[model samples]
Every structure is written in structure tokens, then in C-alpha cells.
Target: MAVAAIAGGTFAFKALDKSVKLVVDGKTQSVSTYASNVEGVLKDANVKVVKRDDLTPKLTAAVADGGTIVLNRARPLAIDIDGVHSKKWVTAYTVEEALSQLGIDGGADVSASRSQRLPLKGASLEVTTPKTVAINVDGQAISVVSTGATVKDVLDAQSISLVEGDFTTPAVDTPVTSGMQVDVTRVRTTTTQEAQPVPYSTSEQPDGTMNKGDKKVVTKGVAGEQVVTYTVTTTNGVVSAKTQVSAQVTVAPVNEVVNVGTKEAPVAAAPAPSGSGAGSSGGGSNAGAIPSSGGLNWPALAQCESSGNPKAVSPAGYMGLYQFDQRTWNANGGSGSPLDASAAQQTAIAQNLYNARGISPWPSCGPKLLS
Candidate 1:
């Protein structure tokens, strides 16, 4: 009786034991378990399963002999799309498989090649779909159909090079999109040396022989020469900014000496007017005949003020040869617009203003006369 009970117990044990195939991430192994269900069989085999893991059969399914249990382990996949970032868990073995399982389109731009296998700890990916874009650069418009992830990639695909000080609109790292307009500014820098005139100084000496308003030039002024080095920056063939780097004097300036009269002239009595009323408009009539006087360089002042253009008008409302504003023109015995007058009239009026204000009106160009 003891031998029969031991034999029956051994038969029952053998009947309950089941042999099945277990596959973990496509790697197959034979498993032997006496457990009744799929969950119990995996536990008996020491297989750890999570919610994200893919199992071939339901955990509650009854375990039978010769059954196959497949478990596909899941891993994290980090993704960035069109600047938006996210993480997803997948049970795929390759980049193509992951993308396919995620329902991502095959034509999208991917950071990794599709056939590349995922690492043990999974991998990261960036994707950008095909887009139509327009780029304006170097005086030309380019239309492109591309699958670049960023604006920089698009530029790189076109063999575009960005040097120092060059830049692009929307930035290089900005994500690309359909119908986007990109502007590329090519900055070119150049160094140039120019000879500029250095202004000379004027000195005055008193002369008692002549009348108060009378003056004479004792020594004429000569401008010095200087080489000015400039850093010129241009964008797309147009000058954007110019900076002076250095200046070296090549020639010393010659100072001007003038003899200014100190004697007070006697005031003449009023001339008797003829019945015809002659010389009523003496100042206006002698416009073209006015000579350069007062010890100052009148021609230089005119040239500097308006580039010798008598009909020049400034954007700031300053008009005529000397760039005089309307208020200053009217205050200095000038009637009507300075533009309406002749070149000789403009010169005569500028001279009259200089006599009254002593070069205060032409503040910017006044120093140019010394040069």
C-alpha cells in the first residue's frame, strides 16, 4: 500500500507539470511550470512584466502543455517634433519599427536612419515632415522642397555659408514650417584708407590803418592731409555701417593769419535822394556783384554748406546755398523762399548773414572753411 500511494503522487505531479515555449523580445526559451495560468507561468519563470510590456496572450488564459508565451519588453523613446517635445514607451526593436508602431509617416525627416536598431535603453529621435519654403538671399529668391528639421539644415543643404556678422531671419535653430519665408543677410566687411583734409586754425592781428569792418588776409590757410582707416560693413551689397578705426596725419596744417581793422570809420551823412529815387534797392541790385570779403573763405563755406549747389534744399527745411532755415533767412533781410532766389542772390544773402551772426548759423559747416 505504501508503494502504490508514492507512485500515484509522482504521477499526479508529472500530470500537473507543463512544458511551454517562452519568448522575451523575440528570444525563445523552453519553460517548465506547474502554474495554472499565463501570469503564474511567467512568475514561475522569473520574468518581470510591466503594464507597458507587450504579452502575446492574456494573463488570465489557462496554461497548457506545448503553449508559447511571448513577452515584448517596452522602453522609453524620446521624441521632438516641430519644436514640441515628448516621450513615448514602445516595444519596437528598430527605428523603423518604432516609427511604424507610433503611426509616424515614413517620409518624415528623422534624426536616425530607419534601419538602425534601437539600443538596449532605447533611443531619441527628431522628425520633420516635408515642407515648401522660400528663402531670399544674395539678391535671389529660392524655392525649396525639403525635409529639414531646422532652418539651419535647410541652409546647409543648399551649401550656404555664414561668415562672421552674417545672420538669418527667424534664426538658424528655429524649426522649419511650410510656406515659411526666410531672409538671409550676408554681411561683408572691408577696410579702406582715405585721405581726409585736416582743418587749419586762424589767428587775427589788429590793424589801425583800416576802418572797423575792413579786413585783409595776411597768410592764406592750407589744409593738412590725413589717412583715415575705416571699417566698412555692408549687407547684400548695400552699405550698412562705417566706423573709423584710425587716423594718421600725413601733412601738418599751415595756420592762417588775418589783419582785422580796429579803427572806427566816420559815419557818412545821408546822401541826397534824386527825384527819380535811385539806389532804393541797393543791396538786392548788387547781389551778383558782391565780392568775397570779411577775412573768411566764402567760397569754401558755400561749397561745404551745399556742395556748391545753389538750389539745394535740406530735408530739415533748410534751403538754398547755405542751408538756411526759413526763420534765419527771414531774420537776415531775406524775403520769400531761399529756393526762389538766384544763385548770386543766395550767395549775397549768405554773406549778409555771416556778417551779422559771425558764422553762428552754419555751425556744422563753419569749421570746414578753415580746412
Candidate 2:
């Protein structure tokens, strides 16, 4: 009985010592044996902790019974995702496992290695990874963007717009990867009036009878215009650059002016007939008298042509009341060289007779001669 009591007492002492209560986060838990540390206890309870998570009582600290020990694990992970800040917590044993457990994919920009071992107590891990994408705007190639998750995310990062008629190198819906390119081209129309100075030119009338100062219409003055299409590149809703892709002329210009006249005079008229002349019927009143009915000034003509000297002889070999040359006097049917009044009157009568018959050598000046 003594041996049995001693063994039972020893077993009871050991059992009491092993059965200790642990206080964690205000919750009490009973353990039958000593564990390595709080981290081991949390692992046994299937509680997951990440490097970014808050924790109390470090993993390296020893556990004490009834000491109100807090089994808080640390799980801290800092992620730089396309210039964005992000954090995650995981109880995974490796970087790859941690990301997977946190619903992160292999395509994500993760800085740490997938097979990299981590501390059991959890430590802060920096993931400096970036998703690469190609960008093209308005037919211009841009450098690959390093950090973006979705198409919209990539555009937002680059401040690019996705509008209708805009083209993309890689469709906007395409997934982003390393060195992937995305292009955007927007369609635009521009209207412009281009005024070209048309040089003036002179034109003649249709009638062929034009003079030096006369002018006519060559081209009417009309305004010219053109319409063009362009592809513009924009960033942050502002136009960055533009390129003309197509153009067309909408209107053409015409020129305009007034006209002036420049012409020479026509010929003169012939002398009147003797019998049909404007004179009195009586021979005594009209035979030796100048006609007064015609608009011609006989006195002025006599003074200018013969200088009141019907018998005068010019040094140029001309004679008679009109100073006619020998050839002209003969052509006009003058009887002889008229050096006196009577001879001049007779010669003038003969010339007038020939002029009335339309047999004179001079061109008829009826159009331009003054009465």
C-alpha cells in the first residue's frame, strides 16, 4: 500500500504540473504539456498569421502558465503594386505560398521568391513587382508601362482615354503582361479656310475689237477652304499631339474686276457737190460766195490752210487754197497750179466735182470729219 500511494502521488504531481491554463487575447486555454512557444500554440490551434498582422508576445518568448500570455502572431507583407501601396497577411511557410494563400496570382508583381523560406514568427516582406504593358497613342509608340493590373488600371496609370474610333495596339480588354504594348488612336476632324492669293490677269472682250485700257472678267473672287482629318494623342483628357491623316479641299477661290476703253478715231468726209451744194439758186448770189448752211467755218479754214494768200507758194512745193502737192492736185483733177484767187477757185471746183463722183484717191473721212 505504501508503494502504491507513493507512485500515485508522484503521478498526480506530474499531471497537475502538466495541466496548466494559458490566457491568450483574454481567452483561457488548458494544455497538458509544455509547448515550444506562443507561435507553436497558435500553429497547433490552426490559427494563421502573416507578417503584416498584429501580434503580441513575440514568437521567441517563452510561455508561462497562468501568466495571461497573449499568443499574438505577426504577419506583415508590404506590396508595391504599380506605384500603389498594398498589404497582406498570411500564415503560409513561403513567399509563394503566402501570396497564393492571400488570393494573389503568379501573374501579380511579387518581389519575393516563391520558394523563399520565411521566419516562423512572421516578418515584414517587400514585394516589389510590376506588371508590364506596351502603350501606343495616336500612332506613336510609347515605352512599356511597368505597373498595372487591368486594362483600365493601365490606362488610368498612364492617363490615357479609351474612346470610340480609337485604336489600341493590344485591345483594351487584353490582359497585361511583361513588355505588353497597348495603343490608342483617336479620330478627329478639323476645318480650315486656306486663302491663297490668286494672281490677277487681264482678259479681252469677246468682240475682238478691244483697246489698251479695256478689261474683262478673268476669274471671280471666291474664298477657298479645306477640311482635314487628324489622329490626336491625349493624356489626362488634354491633347498632347496631333497628326494629319487626311485632307480635302472644300471650296476654291475666284478672282474679279472693271473695264476701261481705249480706241482711235475714224476717217473724215469728202467735199460737197457743186449743183447739190447749200447755196442760193441765183448764180449771181452763190457763184463766188462760200456756203453758210454747212457747220464748217470757211473763214477759219481759209486763214489756216492758205494764210489768206491763195496766190502763196510753199517751200515744200505745195500750191492752191488747200496747199495740195502736185501729185494730190492732179489726182483731185485740179486744172493747173493755183497761185491766184481765180485759179484757186477753179481748182477747188474741179476737186469738189471729182469728190462727188466718188472717184477721188483719198479715203472718205465721213465718220470722223467735223462738219
- lDDT per residue (tens digit) for residues 204-285 in model 1: 9999985454566889999999999999999898999999999999998999998877875442222222212111211111
Residue range 175-276, candidate 2, lDDT tens digits: 566677665767543333333333444443442343322333445545556666666656535677678776666564444443433442122222222221
Q: Which residue ranges in model 1 land beyond 4 Å of their true spot? A: 1-78, 86-93, 116-124, 211-213, 263-371
lDDT of candidate 2 vs native?
A: 0.49
Q: Candidate 2, TM-score vs. the true structure?
A: 0.30
**Per-prediction backbone clash count:** 0, 25
Q: In candidate 1, which residue pairs get closer than 3 Å at backbone N, Cα or C atoms, i.e. clash?
A: none
Candidate 2: Cα lDDT at 15: 54
Model 1 poorest ten-residue lDDT run: 277-286
Best by lDDT: 1
Index of the highest-TM-score prediction:
1
